[model samples]
Every structure is written in C-alpha cells, then in structure tokens.
Target: MATLLGAGPGIVAAGARRTMTRCDGLASVSSSSHGIERVYLSAEHARVNRTVAGWMREIGMTTRVDAAGNLVGRLERATPSGAPDLDAPALVVGSHLDTVPDAGRYDGVVGVLMGLEAVRMLREPGPDGTGWRSPLPFALEVIAFADEEGTRFGRALLGSSAVAGAWDPGWWSLADDGGTTLHEAFVAFGLDPARVGEAARRPEELVGYLEAHIEQGPELDERGESLAVVSSIASARRFQIVVEGEARHAGGTPYDRRRDALLGASEAALAVERVCRAEHHVIGTVGRLETFPGAVNVVPGEARLSLDLRGELDDARDRVWRSIEREVDTIMGRRGLRWRSAEVHRAPAVFCAPLLQDVVREGIVSTLDRGVDDPATIFSRAGHDAMAIGAVTDVGMLFLRNPDGISHHPDEEVSAGDVARGTRALAEAVLQLAADRG
Candidate 1:
C-alpha cells in the first residue's frame, strides 16, 4: 500500500554520536546502573541517572529526577509570543529502561526511543530555518522511568508508583539479594531518601501520557496485524507455594512409605493447569520449582514452586486463586504433606480511558488512511508504566507487531517496516491529541 502522510518526510539528520547512541548509550547506561545486572534498588541503577541526564541535555530538554529517581525531561511549549509555558506540566511520554537478565534489547527501550524520535522530529527546524508548527497543542515531556522489571528488588512498578503517589515510604526498607535497602541505593545515587513524596505530581500537572511498546504476546502476529490499540491490561497474581514432607532414603523407603514433597508438588502443578482449563479467561503457570535434597537416592523433603495467575477480570482472578488454594489443601491432605501458599504480587487490570482510546484509534485509522497497512485489536498481558499514569491522567498505548511474537527474550524481533509504521502512528496520535485538546 502507498504510504499516506500529511507532510513530506522532514529531513531528519541522525542525532550526533550522543543522540545516535541513544540505544547503545541507554544499554550501556543501564549496564552500568547495576554493573550489567542493574536490578531494582541496585547501586548500579544510579549509573543510569547520568546517562539519561546527558541525553536530556543533548535532546534540548531540561532534566530533573524525582524523589523516586524517575527522570523527567521537559520541553516547554512555544507560545504565540514565543514564551515557553513554564506552569504547564506538559504531555508526558516514555517507558522504563531497565531489563531482566540478558533481556531482549527492544522490549522497553523501543518506547523511549520512539518518544525521543518524536521529540527529535518536533525540534528540527523546517527548510526556512523556522520550526514547523506542531499538530499537538501541549508541550511534550519525554520520560525514561526506572525499575519496572523488579528482577532484583522483587517489586515491580517501583519508580512509577512513586510518580503516581502509590509507593509506600516503607518500601524503601525492602531488601535485595545483598540485603541492601532501596532507600540506601537512593542515597548512594545522590537522591534524598526522605523526600520520595516530592516525586508525586497533582493530576492537574499532567496533560496526557503516551507509550509505544512491543506486543509482548503473539496475538498481533498470529492475527496477521501490524499494530494494536491497547484497550486494557490483564490482571495478574503471583504465588509461591511450598509442600513439606519427610525426607526418606530412596533405597530404604518402600514406594508406599515415601512422603515425597516432589510428588505432592507435581500433583499441585497439574491441579493448577486443570483449574485454568475449567475457567475461561484464566491462565496459570508454574514457572519455577526447587526441591530440597535433590539427590538421586533421596526423596525430596521440601518443594517450592512459583505460580503465576492472570485473568481479564478481577473476579476471575479471585476465582482462579480460590480454586488453587482449595487444590493446595486437598493435595496436602491426600499426600500427608504440610503446605503453605503466599501471595508474592498482585496487579489489577487497567482499562485505558475512552478519550485516549479514541486517540489511539484515530491514530491507527489515520495511519491506515494514509496507506499504512492493517492494524489489530489486542490487550497487553504485561503491565506498563501507562497503567500507573492512566490512574492520574489521560493515557494511551500503541503496540507494534512483533514478528516473532516473542518478547522479554534475547531473540525478540520486529520488522523495521512495522517499527516505522508504529512511529508514524504514534507521531500522528500525539499530533491529533495535541491539536484537538479543546
């Protein structure tokens, strides 16, 4: 299909070495933030601060770090009199930059890079040495939030919660693998640990929030779609279950005499799968398992397993959990094992606002109208920074098609054409929302 665009492509010079290295620099910066394993609350995360700050400077935006260490980069609106609006909080756009162990480079980084691209496209002057008028009405604030993965700190959405006023001060005391508190990491990074509240912004200060992300699921590619306007995020719950039984020597104990924790754990795992099958909108996975005394000649005395539960509805999540809890009790009674289950994490489903949903729809439709290919209807299985922002202001999400339908892995891939389409769609969405903010 012929590409449809309102304006001829503006001549965008590649950002100098610093700007060009945005991706490499971001990766390098993240690598240093926690010494190449920058988990949340790690001293290495501090390393990312300088890199982000430097890029904000090169991008011509004034940079500041919030109490939670969320970096906000502001670019004021050029008013009719050429006075930049200082009071306006501006339209915010960005995503987290942290990663899982050797995670795919594109997952969260693409969104931030796209936001930078929008800013770059907006900042370049037209052929006449005058800036082209922007289609969007609000000033843009590009952001690169920290610590969404929780791989190290074991708490997801740490930075965004602070920005949204949802993070508890007590959260600072939470420890990592090295027993280091989040607050101590903050102090080491030159931030005041006591003033995390300062990171909270009143709702009025935000005009809107936009995020572009990869389709972390196979829905888009499976359906042969190029992009998806996210309608809502699924609710997710995580649990850790431990089954205890008496350890017995393999040769000494007869098969009937064994009180094996591994056997009980296996039954519990299959029970989880069965419960999910019985309930629609419910998906359960047991991703990890550790058995005590994992010797070939020994029956395991204790087994610990992780459970991940997801549903499209709140009640569905509750129902699934209840089923699992019941199964755990039944399994323990039959196997003569002591068992316990603990909730590790819970994130409620989030619905994107109708107004912003319209913007996303308009953006996609506009792009297709301009001869962009077909888009898709999809929801995010993974959580996003926008979910927090959605609680505060108008928020929208754009999902680019993943060619491999895989993410959070090293082999994740997206076509360049798909990315370009996503970029145009995002730019169009921002412009439409900005221009029509009456």
Candidate 2:
C-alpha cells in the first residue's frame, strides 16, 4: 500500500487539479443548447475524442479509435531492462466520455481524465529523475467509452457492450430524434458498423477493468468522506405505465361520478415510492408523466408515466416492482380506470470482484491516512459501463464524492482535492494489481 509514484499528497493534488481543468474545458464541447450533451457518434463526440487522444499521446501512449468509435490508448509494459513488452495482458482503466442531455461536467469525464493523469504519473521519472520507480508487469489501457448515457439511441452501454462482445446487430436500426439510425450514424462517424465486433477484447487479453467515477448519490457526502469502494451496481427495471379513464369536464364532474386517469396515475407514483422506501437499498422514481387533453378544465382521459426501479439485488428489485404493480392495480381499479404497463429495460446487478475490491481498498488506503480501519463500501444506484464490461471480465469501481450528491445536471460538481485523491488511488490500484501479478 505504499505510495507508488513517490509524490506527496500536495503534488498529487496539484496534478489532479490540472487534469480536472482539462475535463472542464472538454465539457464545453457539447451538442446541447446550454449544457453538455455529447452523444454517441455525434460531431461533439468526435471533438472530445480528438482532444482526449491528444492528451493520451502526450503521455507516450499509442491511441486509436476502435470500431465502435471508442477512443482507446495503450501504454505497454516495460521489461526489467526498460524495453517494452507487447505480449502482456493489459489492465484497463476508463469510463465513458458521453453524457446525458444537459449533463454536468464530471459525471463521466472525470474518470477518463483521471485515468490519463494516472498513466502520466506512472511514466514520470523517479524522485532522482533517473528511472521509473517500478517496472510495469502488464500493459495499461485507457478507454473513453463512446456511449454510456443512451441519450441518442435510448440504449445504454453500446460502446462497452461491443467491447464485451455483447453487441446486438438489432441496435443498428435504432434511431435518434433526428431520424438517424445508429448504423447510419456510425457510417457518418467513419466507423464500419459491420466491423463493430472488431472492438471486442478477449477475456484472456485483459487482467481486468477498473473505473473511477463520481458517487452520483448522497452516501459519501453525507459521511463526509471523499472516496468509497463500490460493492455493486444496482439492478434496474424500467416500465411505461398507462392509465385510461373517461374524460369529463372538471367543473361538471362530481366525486362520485368522476373517473380520473391522472388521479390514478398520481396514486400509483406515490405507491411506487412507498413500496421502494419499505425496502433497504431500493429506489423507485416516476420521472416522466403526461396526461391526455392537457388542460385544467378537463379531467384527464389517459395518463402515461415512466417508472424506474433499482435495488442492490435483482430479486429484491423485482419484488419491489411487483408490489408497486399491485398498488397501481388497486388504485386504478378504485378510480374506475384501466391500467397497463410495458417493460422497457432490465439490467441485473453486477458485483465487484473480491480481489479487485481488495485492490481498490488498498489503493484508497495508500492515498489517505485518516481512519484506515476500513474504507466505505457503497452500492451504486447509477448505471455505468462497468456493468456491460462485467460480462467478459472482472470489473471494479472507485467512487469519488460528488458535492451535494448531484449528477446528470449542470449543478453537479466535484472538488479538485477529492479528484486528486481519486487520481492517486487509481494509480495506486494499477500498481497494486501489477504487484499481485508479479
């Protein structure tokens, strides 16, 4: 758990601040009207990749755009004699560069910039300025996954799924708001859709995948901690629920004669929250809701709502969803409304590998001196590319605190000091894995 790079906390903090500045600069290159919205295969996506590629090249890493349009950079391992060894299995570290519409700066960008900074720190000369502090036992690969937010195609993890060998050809037909199919967008971006499988990495070619990302929730901030080891990403299910009832004039409708769809939907949303709150580590949100004949003078004839349910365990999430469904049924029946739901998405929870979790803990311990008893372990409610990559290789995550626990919004923020600690922790993690392999 020794400090691998020999830099004191102050020096590492300064380095991380500079890297964060670069990430902030990249955040301005967005496609949205006001906030960041670099979707998959868009022009903004290309610009960010080019800028990140430049940064990667400065660290003496070879860079390429993978078939799936993911920006990839590799630093080969060095032999005892200081020669590069190309045959080594690589340890991959990265996060997505894509952001949700109107996203904050650090949600995904911090991890990529931090990975690059860690690699730069690794290649820096020793204190005496003569040689590297330690030779690498495996290659280091940094990936800026092309798409994680699913803002354009409504399908998350497209980039990581391709890398994990889970890409489905059916996704090519998926379209965006502008009517551009994913396949056409890939072509326009100079990527060959038919060759997307070329992006896949064999399990044997990788040691593992590590990601550093903002906690995107209140846990670490509430505890006054800046870092945590992620235990798992939550299992999630999404559904579109519709309630139908007879429309009536609001002024003419009496309590006994009214069948209000919006009222039933409102009750169902509350029921979802109640059911989710009754369980540990469960969350349910009705993020989008709409009513037919949107007017104050008329009782709603129909209501549509979106339900997103997540939990630390798959079965637990499913159970909560069932309870919510029953509640919705009862509310609709009482209101004389017909209700139906169509599932739109489902993702199983992915647990971190125990060995990699230990490495993450050691990294965190090596970076901080306070209360080394045990670092906080948290379950992530937000979806990440790690979930997709977990299909092929063991995946691990480091969560840095987000001030006010905000994400996917312009108000989301992370401190420079915390990012610096995260950077050092990530670098130390790579070193720890190298030592274990050696």
Candidate 3:
C-alpha cells in the first residue's frame, strides 16, 4: 500500500509542525481571552472563515461559503482554468469548524486543518512552484462545517444537515441563550434562510465523503495505536424528564407520606447508570438536573433532568431506553409521583461504507511500523458532522488518537507525530479512492 502511493514513505517533511502551528493560529479566534470558544454564526466564526479561505487559495482551491455558512474549497482540475463546476463529481473531505464552549484546540479544528494539509500533499507543484494540481479522477472539495458543536444554537449539525439535504425548517425558530432565533442569526450572518436549500448537494455530483477527526475516547490510546478506521458512529437519543409531586413542609411531612420529586429524579438517574452499564457500548448520562421550589425549608415539588443515551446499534439502544423508562416509572409510581418525558433529539447509528473503511485501513497501515500488524478499528462514541452527512452519501472517518480519550475540553490533546501520520494517511486514502474509481 505504501508503494501504491506517489509519496511512498516517511513523514510529509515538517508537515506536522506546520499543521500544529496552524492549529495554534486558529485557537486565537476564540471568543474568550482565556481559551478557545468559537461558535456558530459568530464574529469568531466569520474571522476563521476568512483566514481559512486564504489558506485554501494558497493550495489553488477556489473557495465559497454555502448558504448554511459552511466554508467550501474546491480543487478541481477538470477545468483548465481551475474554476469550480458545481456539477462536477467530487470526493468531499470535511470536518466542522465550530467548537464547544471553552473547547479543546484539536477536536474539530485539527480535522479541518489536516484535511487542508492532505489536499496540499496530494497536489503536484505547478511550474515555478506558484500553485498546485491534482491528478485524480474526481474533483476534491474540503468543507468546514459551521455548527457541529451546536454550542450556540443547542442543535447540532446545522451546516452538514443542509448539505445532506436533511435541513428542517422547524429549526429556524430555535433561539439561543441571547434570545436570537436561528433564522435571525442566519440573516445577521449574511445568509438568507430561504436560500439555504441551495446549499444541498446532489447525490450524483458526489463521489463520496471522508472526514478525519481526533478519537474522542481512550480505545486507540489504550491500545497504543495512533490512527484507526472508524467502523461506525453511535446512535443517540436525548430526552428531558420531569417529575411532579406536591410541595410540602420539609420537616412537617412524615417520611411515609412525603412524595418527593427530587428523590424520584435522583433514583431515576441512578437507574439509568445501572441499566445502561449492563449493555456494551451503551452510555446514559444525566448531565443537567434542576429541582424546583427555592426555599430550603420546602420540599421540591418538581424536578427536571436531561438524558443522553447512545449505543452502537439502534435496536440495542431502543431496548436500553425502554428499560430506563420502566425503571423511571417504577421509581415515580412507588414515590406517589407523576412523571413525563419529552424527546429533544434522536440520531441513528451510521456505519462506514466498506470501501471507504478498507481504504482508511490501508492508509493507516502505510504509516505504521511493520512490527505491529493490523491497524486499529474503532467505533466513534461521540457524534460528529459525519453523522448528518451520512444521510446523503457514502461517509467514513479516520480517528486519530486523542490522549486520555477526552474531548470538548481545553485539555484534549493530539501529538505532532500523530498529525503527520494522520495527514499522510488521509491523503493516501483520497488517492486510493481515485485509483479504485478509475
């Protein structure tokens, strides 16, 4: 596989250092003076788009911003003039540009920069080294999706959903903490909501979509592997559960007579951990909880908690969810309390296309030492832009190891060596797809 690639072997020659420098540079676009905190449709978002657009131009890729605010760079050699042709078949490589609040530097940003570097590596230097050229059968396009983190709008995949043709108009009414509706933000960001459909890509015009991201878990790091072919992205279901009970005098109510909603919610949360832990790849987290009736002397009459459940398969996840519901029902009924749940979000599991998986595997193999056989294979526990993009085309991912399997935080880290390997592997995968397509 190494011989199959034009570059053959070794690091891309200080490519990793340049990649790290770029990551550091982008971290400056943070909203907070203390750490990285870029969000969708923000001044920070617009600034980074301008900065990345200049980098895309450096590699001879013509760039544009989609109606959903995603930055797209196309490197199509089909036209001698190098102008973009929307109808041209292209292999799209992308990752989100947005970040969670107080976010890690590498989570989504590294993937985007790596994609940019991979495109740089795939090109042949133009005469006198002024620009570059691609020898692939299909055009190459890199996308920096706008809202994968959903930090500002509270709904993820706003950018990729539009490209995947799965945009829901209902989302326009959603407002942020600042009270600005999504529709208003779009307009403020210089995007027309009515024209967002223009951002959708035709299936025939796409060859496939590939993304490179930091592994958000400990599997790769624990196994001493730096890269893996992502087998699948976990399915997720989110809900808001509310428990209702009578507010009473905290000290006056007898133990047997008191119907405590806070107690019910607390027990339900424990039940979720117990039930979900029994299943493989099943995770249930009660991240947000609130107990009502402010006085310390008064018993809480209402409690609300958020449930985020994820699993490797849909059936298994549903089974776990049902189990949790039964547990909650029992806890509430036994306590003489009423309970209800409202679903907030749901996303089904997405498996990588077999061909894409194979190429990614080979790409990783090309960069590893011969002492170790078989590159690692992993399933993504965290949701990504790939989940939404999978709806429209054959989608796949390359997971580069992140130390301690931690993400969405300032401490998440990726090494320079891993970046070099990851950059080369991604480029190789793109070249391999070209070879197979031809």
Candidate 4:
C-alpha cells in the first residue's frame, strides 16, 4: 500500500521517519503499561494524565480543568488574548485517562496522544512556502477524560457523564476501594463539584467529536486489517448476584448436604457462557468474585459475583439477561439455595452518525489506500468517551488494531505503521469536518 497522503505539502515526505518515531512513541506509551504493572493502582493513572497535559502545554495550548476533573487543552483559531472569542463551533477529540488495574497504556493514551500530535503536526509551519500555519479550520479542543473504565469507582463514564450533564452530583458520594468519593477526588484535584453542571452545552455548539482507540478485539487481526472504523458502541448490562447457602465444616459436611453458594455461583457462571454463546454478539463474563466467612476447610456460606453482559443489539443483550434469570431460577430450585440479583448497569447500544462514519472511511481511503481486500469497517464491543459525547454531537471513532488482541493488560500493542495510518485517516477526517462545505 502507498503511504498515507496528508493534506499539506511535505506532510507525506516525513512518513518513513515518522513511522519509526511513532514506533518509539508506542514503545514509550507501552512503557507506561509496564510501570502500571509495577505499581499498585498503576502510577500510570497520574503519569498518563500528566503526560497528555504536558504535551498540550508544551505546544503552547491553553489548558483548563472542568468541574468534573476533565482535562481540556484548547488550540484556538485565534489565541484567547489576541483573537475574538472562538466564534465558530469547536471540534473536540478526546478519550479517557483512567485505566483498569494493570491495563495497557495504549488503551487510553493512544487517542490522547494522536489528538495532541495532530494538533502539533498541524501547528507546524505548512510546507516550504506556506509559512507558519495551523491546519485546523475550527477551534480544536483535546480532552483527556478522568474516568471511563468504571474500574476504581465502579461507574463508567464518570467524567463524560458530568460533561454530558447526565450524571447527578449525588452520585459523587459513591466510594471506591480506598473509600474516596469522587467529590473528594475532585477537591483534591482542585476542582469545584458545584461547577460540574456547567459542563453541558447545547448540541449545536460542537462541530464533531472524534476518538482514535485500540480495537480491543480480534476482528482486525482475524481479517488481516490494520484498522477498524467503528460503526456502533456495544450495549452493556451488568449485574450483581448474591447466593445464600448453609455453611458446614468441609470435612463433616456430606456432598449431598452441602448447599454451597460458591457451587451455585459456579453453575451460574457456566450458564452465562451457554447463554452468550447462543447469540452472535453477546458476551457474558464473571469478572469479580467474593466469598463470605472465607476459610479453607469450610463450605462456602455466601458468594457474590459481578456479571458483565454485552451485545451489539438491545434485544440480544436483553435475551442474555433473561437466559441468566432462568438459569438462576433453575439453580435455586434444584439447590434449594436463596439468591438475589440486582441490576448494576445498563447502557444501550449507541450507533455512530452515518455521515461521520462515512467521513472517517473517506479519510482512510484517501490516505492509506489499502484497497477492498483490507476493508476496515466493523462493530466495536468496547465502550468509549464518544458514547457519552455522542449524546450531544455528531461523533465518530477510529480503531488501531491491537496486535495481540490484548488490552487492559501490560502487553498491549499497536504498530507504528498502524499509528501512522490511523493518524493520517484521523487528520483527513478532521479536516473534512472542520471545513464548512454547506
């Protein structure tokens, strides 16, 4: 495939060298992944946050922290002190900053890095004769959202929900493993919780929102494609199940007399698989487990499990839940154990704006020219900041295929060639959206 062409003269000229540089950048980002593994809670949390903010400031962009602790760096068409208020609707490119425990750096950092680098690249003097210039037509804002993993706080899209005005301030009282409330964290970050309401805006104010993220799936590698143009964000339904059973000494308890909660929970876990496997896009996983009165020689008295159910369609996703319900009923009837299931989360599938997806596709076709054999459009199982932002704007996403189909781990990777390809596509797409063709 020919190198991805850029909008400006001499942009493609540095493609080869830039490819190596991007590889180094990926290595640098991946290094943070290693650091995450070495530390508790992954110091990458603060490091990734600082790295992105540092990059933004290094380029002379003005920075601000919103009420929800969202980090925003702005590159205005005209400087704040020099030009009229950024009149035209603004373009926003962003992704989350928080990570799952021991997560790969590229999962969240790639989008932040790509957006920052694009702004940096565009800010450079244009070609040989064009002189000092910025390629962006509209004011561009790069945001590194505080939390999207729901990892530490048990709530996905915390920062984005605040920005979208969907979150209630009362939710800030929710605590984490450290017993720190989001409100407390906000204060520590020097942001005012009272101002969180100010983050929302009328939908028309944003031109478009774009995010480049890791695929987190094997579709690209399975199909031999380098990128995946996202069509829709998957729906997620999470639940917590608690099982009650009689506890007895492991040595004294007869197998038939044991009404073990862990035993019942195990059956439910297997049922989750049976249900999800019956459908095309459904995914059911039991990611967390806790035992009550934990002991090595005792029959488990109680067990709590967290179930994550996901799918591309609301109906299909719901079906998996129904299957789980039936399985739980059967297990209780047979085991004679009491159980209770509570809904933890339910986010419906969000479709990308067709026009925005088309624009991204055009960017890929124009820049990479990988041909039909390596077609790039596909569905994404992962959720993103764009899902919340999409509620208020025309939103789109670009996926850089993870080499090993690994994510949320220390070994995540996306090749430098892939980054270059993805960037060219994103840059071109941003240019198209920023242009006022109407």
- For all candidates in order, the CA lDDT equals 0.75, 0.90, 0.88, 0.74
Q: Report clash pairs, candidate 4.
A: none
Residues 1-438, candidate 1: write the lDDT tens digits.
Answer: 222234334322332222335655555644433333456545556666667667667768898877887778888877678888788667888888778876766777777777776675566554645334453456788777888887867888888888887877667788777877887778876789878888877788988888888888888888777789988888999999999999889899987788899999999999999999999877899999999988988999999999999888879989989988898899889888999989988888888777777677776776565555446656777888887777778778899888768877767776655665666667667776765675
Distance from true position, residue 408, model 3, in Å? Answer: 0.9
Residue 345 accuracy (lDDT) in model 3: 95
Task: State every prediction's TM-score relative to the real structure.
Answer: 0.90, 0.96, 0.95, 0.88
Compared with the true structure, what per-residue lDDT tens digits does model 3 show for residues 100-132? 888888888888888888888777542445333
Residue 362 error for model 2, in Å? 0.5
lDDT score, candidate 2, position 349: 100
Candidate maximizing TM-score: 2
Give per-residue CA lDDT, model 2, range 1-438, as digits (tens): 465556565567767888878978998898877778899999999999999999999989999999999999999988778788888888999999998988899988999999988887787753545324566788999999999999899999999999999999999899999899999999999988889999999999999999999999989999999899999999999999999998899999898999889989999989998898899999999999999998989999999999999999999999898888788888887888999999999999999999899889888998677667488999999999999999989999999999889889999989998998899889888888888887
Query: What total of clashing residue pairs does each candidate reach?
Result: 6, 0, 1, 0
Q: Provide the lDDT at 216 for model 3.
A: 91
Error of 3 at 210 (Å): 0.6
Candidate 2's error at 156, in angstroms?
A: 1.2
Worst 10 residues of 1 by lDDT: 11-20
lDDT of 4 by residue, 158-253 (tens): 778877778776777877778888777667666677887877756766787889898997888787777777999999888999999988999999
For residue 309, model 3's alpha carbon misses the true position, in angstroms, by 0.5
